[model samples]
Target chain A: MSGPYGTMAEKVLMKGNEAIAEAAILAGCRHYFGYPITPQTEVAAYMAKRMPKIGGTFLQAESEIAAINMVMGVASTGRRTMTSSSSPGISLKAEGLSYLAGCDLPALVVNVERGGPGLGGIQPSQSDYFQATRGAAHGDFRMIVLAPASVQEMADLTMHGFDLADKYRMTSMILADGTMGQMMEPVSLEAPEVKTYDKSWAVTGTDCKRPHNIVNSLYLVPEDLERTNFERYERYRTIEENEVMYEEFMMEDAEICIAAFGVAARVSKNAIMAARAEGIKVGMIRPITLWPFPKAAFKKAAEHVNTFVSVELSMGQMIEDVRLATECARPVVLCNRAGGMIPSPEEVLQRIKEVNGGMTK
Target chain B: MTTQILIAGFGGQGVLFSGKFLAYKAMMEEREVSWLPSYGPEMRGGTANCSVIVSDAPVGSPIVTKPDVLIAMNLPSLDKYENAVAPGGIIIVDSTLIARKVERTDVAVYYIPATQMASDEGITTLANMIILGKLIRVCDAVSNDNLEAALKKVVSARRADMLDLNKKAIELGFNYAD
Candidate 1:
C-alpha cells in the first residue's frame, strides 16, 4: 500500500508486538522500560535488540510496576517513553498509571491483553476492556485508549499514541490482545514527523533562563488535590469532545447493530457480511478510540437500530458503555468468549439472528 | 484475491521461516502481507506456528481461524490444523515427518519430502524454503518473478553468503513438484 508520503512503496512483514516497538522508535521514543510476559514479550525483545542500535535506552525492569515507574521517570524529563505488558502485568502497573495521571505526564503504556481477572491464559482476550477504559488506576482520571485490530494499526497507533500523549499531557494506551501481538502483518516503517515539546515543565536541571521544574504527584492539601483532579477532568472533557474515533459500516438502514473493537471487531465484520448475505439488516460500529468511547456515534445509530449486540473476547465488560451510550433506546446484548478464546463469526451471526428475531416480535 | 495461511511444525523444523518466505514473496509483489509467529510457551518443545496473510486490500484481521492454506511440517501440525483449513482450501504436508494422510477430501493436499530434498541439496536448513517453493507452485499465490525477488530481499542482508544454496533449493523444489 502507498504510505502517507506516497514516495516509497511500503511493505515490511512485522509482528504486531514488534511493530509497536518499531513504531515507538520511529516516533522518536528514546526510552522503553518493560517486563517480560507472554504474548507481549516481543515488544521488549524488539526494543532490546534494536534500541541500542539507534542510541535509545531499553531497560528490562524488575516488574511491571517498576517498568511503568521508569516510564514516568523518563517521561517527566520530556523524552518520549513507553512500557508494555500483558493483562496481569498491566494490573501491576495500575498504581503507577494513577501517578502518571496525577502528575500529568505524557507516556505510552501498552496492554497486550490476555484472558484475565487474575493470571489468565496467554492467549488473546478483551477482558481488559473495563480496566483500560474505566481507569484501572484509582481516582477520576481518564486515559486515551486506542484499540488496534491489525498489525499495521499496532504500529500506527503506537506512534499516534505518543503524539496524543504529548498533546494531551496524559498517558495513552494501545489496548491490544495476544492475537494482535502474536500475529504478523505487512507494515511500512516510516519515521513520523518529529514533534518537539515545551520542556519548561520538565524536571531538567534549572538553567539561567528558567527556574527548576518540580515533577510530583503530591498535592498534600485536600483543596489543592481536588483542584488538580478537576483540572484533569477538564482535560478529559476536551479529549472526549475532539478525539472520539469510530468506524461505521452498513448502518444506513440497519435493524440490528453490532458494536465491537480490536479483534472482536474483525470477527464482527465477517459476521456482519454473513448476516447481510442472509438478508438480515445488520451493521457494525467499530471504536478505534475506546476511552473516548464513541458515544456520539452509538447514540446516532441507536435512533434507527432496534438492537445492539456487543461482541468481545471477554464476557461483558464493554456492554456497560454501550448501554450508557445508546441510552437504553435499544436492547443491548453481549456475545462473548473469554479465557483466551476468540469469538467466532458464526457465534456473532447467531446472536445477530437472535437479536433480529427478538426485535421483530 | 488474497489468502491467509498458517504453517505449523515443531521447533527447528522451519515452520516460521516458511511463513516468512511467503510473506516476503507477497511483499515483493507489492501486495499487503504479514507474518505472525507463535511465541511464549509454545516456542519451547510445543507446536510452533506462524500466520501469513497476503491481501490486495488493507488486511482487517491478522488472526486466521480458518486459513486458506496450511503447510503442516509435522504430524502434530497436521493433526492440529488439518480441520481448520477452509473448504476448497489447500494443505501441504511433509511426507518425511507426517505419517498420517489427511482424511478430508474437500481440500487439496500435497505431500512433499521437503526435509529429504533439503538434505539432498546439502543444506539442511533450507527445508523451509523447499516447502515455500512448493507452496508457490501449487498455490500460485504469488508469481515466480515475485518469489525470486522476495528470496533475494530476505536473504540479502542476513544470509547473503548462502543465497546460491537457497536459490538451488527453491528451484529443486519447484522442479520436483511435477
Candidate 2:
C-alpha cells in the first residue's frame, strides 16, 4: 500500500460519509439500516451501492425508528451492525438509543448532525452536543461518543466505534457535524488493529446444544433496574479512566486555553497558529472522546491558563462540561455560532485577542 | 506551502467535480488535500461552491474563508467571492459567462473565456476543467505530473472515453493566450 511517499500507506480521496461506510465494512460490519437524511444519506447510499456486491445487508427502513429497531435485531445476533442519521433523525432514534443502552447491545450509531431544536436546516452544526453527550434518551445511561474533526478521523473513528461498542457491550456513537460528514479528504483505508470480544451472550440459535440466550431490556422490579443502572455507571467510570482520548496543541506555556472538538477544533487550530504568529500565548485542548470529557487535561490546563474559551456550534453545550472539568476556577467564555453557522478562525482569533486583553486588566 | 482554493458556479457547471479533480491530483502527488462542497437542498439553477485545500502541512479547516485561489464560473460567484481572496492571491474567472471586470486591486485576476473555449472546441460541459487548467498554472494547487492519473480516478471507468476529452480541454486552457 505504499504511495509516492515511500512506505506511507496508499490513500483514497473519499467523502467523510463514504469513508465511514467503507471503514465500517473493513471493520466487519455486514448489516446497515438507515433512512435517508440530509448530510448523512451518503452513508446509506454507499452501503446501498456496495453491500449487495459483498453479500451484506443494506436495508433502507421505512423510518428512522424502524431502522434503529432493525439494528437492535441484528445486534442481538452479535454481529457488527450500524445505522446513521442527522440531527432531527437522531432525535427520532433516541428511544432506540436508550433501549440499546438498557439491553447492553453492542452496535455503532453515527450522527452527522445538522442544526436543530426542531426540523432545523440541513447545514453543518454541533448543536446536538447536549443531545449526544448528556441526553441521548430518557434513561440515565451514557453512550461512547467519538467526535471526528477530519474525514480521516471519520473513517478511523468508525472502525474504532465498532471495537469500542463490542468491548463495552453498549452503543458507540460517531458524533460528527455535517461538515465532517460532507467533506472529502485523503484517507488511508488500512485495516485497524482489532480486539475481539466474547459474544457468547448473543442470542444465536442454540441448536439444542446449550441454553437459549434471551435478549431483553425490561426489568420489572425497581431494584433490578437500579442495580443495572449502578452496573452501567461502574462501566462508565472504567471507560472514563481507560478510554479518554484528546489532543493538546501549544499548551506548554499557554495563558489562554481553548476547549473545542470536531470542526470547531479544526477552526481553532487555524486561529491558534495565527495567534501564535502575533505572539499570543493561546492553545487548545481538543477532546476526541466527547463522553469522557477529557476532564483531567482541562483541569491541568486550568492550573496555568488565565482564560478558557469554549468554542462551539451550539449556543453553549460542551462549555458546561468545560466549566465542570475546570471547576470554574478559570473564566470560560463562549465563542459560538448556532443554527448551522460555523465560527470562523477570525472570530475565534478575535475571541482570543479579547480574552488576552482582559488578562492585562 | 498551503493553497486554499474556492471554486464556485451554477449547480450544473461541475464546480464540485472540478474541485474533486484538483484534490485527487494533489492526493496523487502525496500532498495533504481536502475538498468540501457547499451542499444542501438546491436545484440545478442554484449557486454551488466548493472549498479545496492543498497543503504540504495538514489542513486545519476545510472551510476556506480566505482562499489563495478563486475559480469563479459565473458572475454571481465572482461577485460573491471576489472580495474573499487573499491579498496577492489568484482569481480565475470564466470570462465568457461573467462579463464584468474584476473589481479587486489586491489580487491577480485571470479572465479566461473558458465556456467559449470549451463550446468552440465542442466540449461545453468541460468549462470547469478548462478553468481548472488555468488554476494549476496560476498556483501550485496540484502538480501537472498527475493530472491524467487523477482524472482516471474520478471519471468512472464507464466514462473512460471522457479521459482524453478532458485532457484536451485542460490543454486548451493551459496554453490559452489569455
Candidate 3:
C-alpha cells in the first residue's frame, strides 16, 4: 500500500470503480480481462489505464465470455486475475463462472450491477441476488459473494476477494451495485497485508521437472464429478462457518430489525437512525457477505426483533434469504424499489413506523 | 450535522466537477464526504447531476433525496428539483440559463448569472466553479481555505492553465452581492 502509490495513509477522493482497480493492483492482480458495460465501465477504464503502468495485462476481450475465459486462462497459471461487468454482461459470463468453479480455479469477478432481468436500465439495483448467491450458471457450486456498501469497502473487499479466492481455491465475487461502483469517497490506499497460497497445482511449464499440471472442468466419469461437487460443498461449509461478515447497528434492546446490504444497507442505516430519533426501537443487520447470507446474524436478530424489514433496490430479491436465514421465526417484510430506483430514507422510515404499528396492534 | 447538496445542469457544464470540488474541500478538512455523479447516456450532452454530502458523521446514503442546497444550472434541473429542496435550504440558480424564478418561499434563493459572468470573464466553461464559490460564501458547506489545492487535484495536469481562470471565476461569484 505504501510503495509507488506514496503517502498511502493520506486520503484521496476516488470513485468506487477506481478504488477497486487500484486495490486489485495492490493485491498483486496482474491480469484484468473485461468488456465494457454501463455503470461499470469505469472499472474497465481504470484498469486499462493503470494495468499498463504497473506492468500488468489489461485486455479488453471481445465479449463477456471471452473476458471470463481470459480470466480462467490466467487463473490456471496461478496468477491473480479479475474481470468486471454489469448485469447483462454478467449474465454472459455465467457459463464461464460455472467452468471456473468446476475447474476449482481461484479468481475475482466484480459485478457492478445495474437494474436487470434483461438490459433493465443503467441504474443501481440488487436484482442479481439470487443469481450471485445461487452460483450464476447451471451448477452445484458456489462463489463467495462479498457485498460492499461503500467506496471504502469497494476497495477493501476487492483485496479481500483476491485473498479469499486463493484461500478457498474458488471464485470470490464482489457483488456491488451501480451506486457502490459509481460513487466517490475518501479512501486510504494503504496496502493491506496480502496473503498468498501455494500454487503447486497450477498449470505452469513442467520443463521436464515433473508431470504437467492439467486444468479442466469436464469430468467424463460421473463419480469423479460427484466427488468434486462434494469437495466443493465441503469448502463452502468451511467458508460459511468462517467467512460470514456483518455489522449490527443499534440492535441492542431492539424490537424491529432491518436486513439490508450494499446501497440498501446504507439507506437502511439512515432510516434506522431516523426511526431511533423518533423513539422507535429499530436497528439493522447489514450483511457484508451475501452468499453465506449471514444466517447467524439474522437468526440472532430474529430472537430479539418483532419484525425484519428487508430493504433492497430490487423487488425484494434478498428477502427470500432473510426469511430462510431466520428460518421464518420472525416476519420478514419487504421495503424495496425496482427497475433501478432506490428506496429513500423517508420511505424506509415509514416502513419501519408501519412495522412498529403492526407489532403494537 | 449533514449537508446534502445537489448540482444539476447539462453535461458540458461541469456539474460533476463542481461536486468533486466541494467533496474534496470537505475531505481536506477531515470531514466525511461523498460525491456521486449521474452517469450513462446523460453524459453525452444530456442533463447531468451530482449528489454531494458533507457530514459530521459517516455518510449513510450517497444519493441526495431532499437536498439541503440545490444548484440549478438549467431550466429542467430547476423545474425538476425545485420542490425537492429541504425547507430553509439554499437554492442557487444560474440566471443565465434558467429563466424562471424559484416558486418556493421556504428556502433561500440566490440567482447568480454564473454562465453570463463566466462568459463576460472569458471563462465560460467554469460557471460551475463560480456557483461553487457562491455556495461557499452563502453557506459554510465548505471553507474557502485549500480551495486552490482542491482545484489542483480535480483539474487534471493537462488543463493546468484553467487553474487561474477558475480561481478568478470563483472570486467573482464569492464577491457578488445582491
Model 3: lDDT of residue A226:
92
List model 1 lDDT by residue over A202-283, tens digit each. 8877777777788889987999999988888888999999988888989999889889998899888878888999999999
Candidate 2: tens digits of C-alpha lDDT, residues A72-152: 999999999999999999999999999999999999999999998899899899988888889999999999999998887
lDDT of 3 at A317: 80
What overall lDDT, based on C-alpha atoms, would model 1 receive against the true structure?
0.85
- Residue-wise C-alpha lDDT for candidate 3, range B26-76, written one tens digit per residue: 988878899999886875479999999999899999999899999999999
- What value does the lDDT take at residue A204 in candidate 3? 89
Each model's backbone clash number: 5, 0, 1
Query: What does candidate 2's lDDT look like per residue over B13-121, in tens digits?
Result: 9999999998999887878888999997766889999999999888888899999999999989999999989999999989999999999999999999999999999
- Misplaced by over 4 Å in model 2 are A1-8, A359-361
lDDT, candidate 1, at A156: 86
Task: Please rank every candidate by lDDT, starting with the best.
Answer: 2, 3, 1
TM-score of chain B of 2: 0.98
In Å, candidate 2's interface RMSD is: 1.3
Write down the TM-score of model 3's second chain. Answer: 0.97
lDDT of all predictions, in order shown?
Answer: 0.85, 0.92, 0.91
Sorted into a CAPRI-style docking class, model 3 comes out as medium
* Candidate 2 residue A233 C-alpha distance from true site, Å: 1.3
